[model samples]
Target: MQNILFRLGFLACFCSSAFSGVTYPPITIDLQNKPPGHQITEFRTLTILIDTRIDVININAGVGFFLIQVHSYMGNITLSDDSDAQISGTNIGLIWKGNSENVAHFYLFRDHLALLDNITMLIAVSTYSKYDPVPGGCNLSFETEIAPYQKISESDDFITVISQPPSQFGNFCNRSNIVTRMYYLYLSEHDNSTEQYFANIQKMISVDDIVKYGTLVLEGLTANRFKQMYSRYAGTGRVFAAVSTRLGRSAAYVPAVSYGCDVAAWDADCSGPGKDIFSFISGLAFALLWLFLWRKFGIPVVAVQLAFLLNGLLVASILFYSQLGDIYIFANDATFWTCFVCLLIVTQKPFGCLTSLFYIIALSLVGSYAVIFAVNYYVGGNLPYILLNTYRRITVANFGSAVIAPPYQTMDICQTGLWVLIFCIGVYVQTRSSMGRPPFPPRRADRARARVDENTPLIEPNQEMPPAYFEAVYS
Candidate 1:
C-alpha cells in the first residue's frame, strides 16, 4: 500500500512538471512587460515571436520534447534582425509551419533564422531519440502525438506516430475543413550562419516581397510571462483562434501568389472597370436567380450547373494536356463532377428526398460562387483565380486575360463577408420556402377529393335509395 501511494505521488509530481515545465534561460529576464506568448504544456508546445530587438530564446522542456511552430496564421515568426541569435537549443524541435510561402525554408535547418514573410510549410520534428522531417507537410491533427502512453519499461516505451497528409493540393483540403497554411514546426537543431540563412531565404522571398507584403511584429512579455500565460490561459485561446481564423479567412488557406486563372494572360485582360461591371451584373443575376427561382425551377438551375460542370471538365482535360496547373487540379474538378453526377443519379429513385438537399447545395454554391467571382475579379484576389486554376479549371474561366492577381495584404474582407452573407441568406430563404412542401410534386388535394366523390354511391346507407341512385347503379 505504501509503495502504491509513493508511486501515485511520484506520478502526480511528474504530471505537474510535464504540464508546466518549459524554462527559459536567464538572459530573457529584461523582457518582463510585453504580451505573453502562447504555450500548451500538455502537448509540450510553446510559441514565441522574436523581432529585431530581442535575441536568444532558449526553451528547455521537462519530461518530453518541445514543439515550436513559427506559423503564419497565429501571426508570423520573423527573424528580421541580423543580430538575432538562435531561439532554441538542442533536443528541442521547430516546425517551420506555414503555406508554400513559409515552408520553403524547411531545408534551411535550425540555429539559423531568417527574414520570413512567406515560406510554404515543411514540417520537421527532432525528437530526443531522433529527428524526422516530414516533407509532405504539417498535420493539424498532430496534437495526438503527445497523448499519454503506456510504458513497456524505460528502455523501450511505446509512442504514437501519426501523419495526415493534407488534401489541399487537389482542393480536397477545403472540403475536409483543413487549413493548409498552418505549420506546426516540431523543434529541430542544425548549424547554419544567420547570413547564409537569410541569403537562402532571400532567394525565394526577396527584399521586394517583404517591402510589398510589409512585416508582422508580434510582441510578447518576458519568457516568464509566457509561463504565466500558459499556466493561466493555455488551451482556451486555441479553440477561439481556430474559430475566428476560419471565419475570417473563408475557411481555407489561400497562398500569397497562386496560379491565376489567366496566369499567362495580358494584364489588361484580367482587370478593368468594364469587366468588373459585367462580372458584377452576371454574378448578381445568378445570385438572384438562385434565391428566387431555384425552388420553383430547379431543373433550369441544374441545367446551368451541368453546363458549367461539363465546361469545367473539358477545361480540366485541356489543362492536363497542356500541363498548366498540374494533375491535382484536374483531379479535383473531376471529383466534383463525379460527385455531382452521382448525386443526380441517386435522387431519381432510392433517395428522392435528396433532391431537396441537392437543390439547397446547388443554390448555396451558386450564391457563393457568384459573390466570390465578382469580388475577387474587382480586387484581383487570389481565391477566384485559385478557384479557376485549381478547382473549376473551366474553359473561359479567366477573370480577365490581361489581369494579374496581385498579392493582397489580407483576404478581401468584403468578399468573405458578402460570400457568407449571401450563402446564409440563400440557405435561409430556400429552407423556409421549402417548409411543409413535398420533395416532389403530388396530385392536387382537390383533385383527389373529387376522384373519391366520383367513386362513392350517391345514397345514404340507412335510408331508402333515391331513384336517381338506383338508376345510376343499374346503368
Candidate 2:
C-alpha cells in the first residue's frame, strides 16, 4: 500500500508540471531619460507581455479566465489586449477560448501629468478555471514608476516649467526654483522649421540653475506648421503665453486652456474695443480722393458704379483671406440692397450725389449693426466666437501657422469712416457749388425776365415805359 501511494504522488506531481503554462518575467518599464523621471510632454503608450497560457484544457472544459488590474494616479488610463480587444474598467477580466495556446498582451495609454511630481502604476494579472480547478493557480504582478515634472504656470501661448524641490531638503538647499518662461510671438517674417522650432525652445531652457525667459517668434508659418508646433509643445510644461500685436490696442495675450488653445478675453474675430485708426485714416483719404475726382472731372455714373463694385469685391476678398468672409458677405449684401433701394427712390430727383451719400452712410450704420447681430447669433451669443472659431478651424485644418485673423475692429471702423467721409464730401461739394445761389438752377423764363429788367436799367423808379412797349419787351 505504501509503494502504491508513493507512485500516485509521483504521477500527480508530474501531471501538474506538464499542465502548467509558461510564466512571463516581471516587466520593468523605465521612462527615465536624462531627467531620471518619466517626464512626458503630451501622452504615452505602453505595451507589455503578461503571460502565455495553454488554452487546450480550458477549451475542453468550456471555462477560462484572464484578469488585469491597473492602479495609478495618472490623469487618465486606457487598457487593451493584443487582439485589439478593449478591456473595460480599471479591474479588467479578459475572456479567452480556443484550442491553441495564446499570449496575453496588454496595452496602456497614460494622460498628461500636468501638476504631479510622481505617479505609480501597478499591474496585476491572474487566470483561473471554473471546473477542474488546477492546484496552485498562477498569479503575477508588477509596478511601473512614473515621475511627472510639476508645472509652474501656463497660458495659451506658452507654458513655464520648474523642478520641484525635495520635501526633505528644506528651503535652505533648494536652489532657486528653476523657473523658465517661454514666450511665443507671431511675427510677419519668421518661418521656423520643426527642428529649428524645437531647438529654439530647448535653447531657452539650456541655462543651468537660473531663472530665465525666452521668446520664440514664429513668422509667416503655414497654418499646419503653426498648429503642429502649438499642439506638440503647448502642454509640455514649458510655454507661458503667446502674444500678438494690434495697430492701436495693447498686445493681445493667448493662454492655453484645458478645453483648447485660445486668446484670453479677446474677441475671436480679433475685433477689440478700439477703432482701427489706420484703416479709418486710409478710408477717409480714399473717400476724399473719390470726391475730388467726382467734383473736378465729373466722373461718369457708370464709372462710379464700377468703382463701388470693385471696392466691394476687394473688401470681400480681404475678408475671405482673413477668415471673416461670412461676415463681410453678409454686411456687403445688406449694404448693397439698402443703397440700391434708396438710390432707386431718388433716381429721378436732382442732387443725386447728395442723396446717394446719405444712403451710403445710413446703410453703413445699419449694416454694421446687422453684422454684429448675425455674428452674435451664429456664435451663440458669444462676441468672440469669430476669433475662437477662426483659431479652432485653422488649427484643425493645419493652417494655424499661416492664416491669421485681421484686426476686425479696424476693418469695421475704416469702413464706417469711409462712408461718413463720403457723406462729408457730398456736404462740402453742395456747400461750395451752391453757396450764393439757389440750390436748383433758375427756369429759362425767369432768366429772360431778369435779363430784360437789367437791360431796362433804373426804369423802375423814374422812367415809365408805354404799356405797348412794356408788353413787347416782356414778350
Highest lDDT: give the candidate number.
2
The best candidate by TM-score is: 1
Per-residue alpha-carbon lDDT of candidate 2 for residues 75-185, written as tens digits (9 for 90 to 100): 344454445343222222233322254334444533433323333444433232332111111111111111111223333432232222211111122222322122432
lDDT at position 293, candidate 1: 54
TM-scores across all candidates? Answer: 0.27, 0.23
* Model 1 TM-score, all chains together: 0.27
What residue runs in model 2 are displaced by over 4 Å at the alpha carbon? 1-255, 258-274, 301-306, 311-475
CA lDDT of each prediction against the hidden true structure? 0.30, 0.33
Give the poorly placed runs of model 1, Cα more than 4 Å off. Answer: 1-352, 390-409, 412-414, 438-475
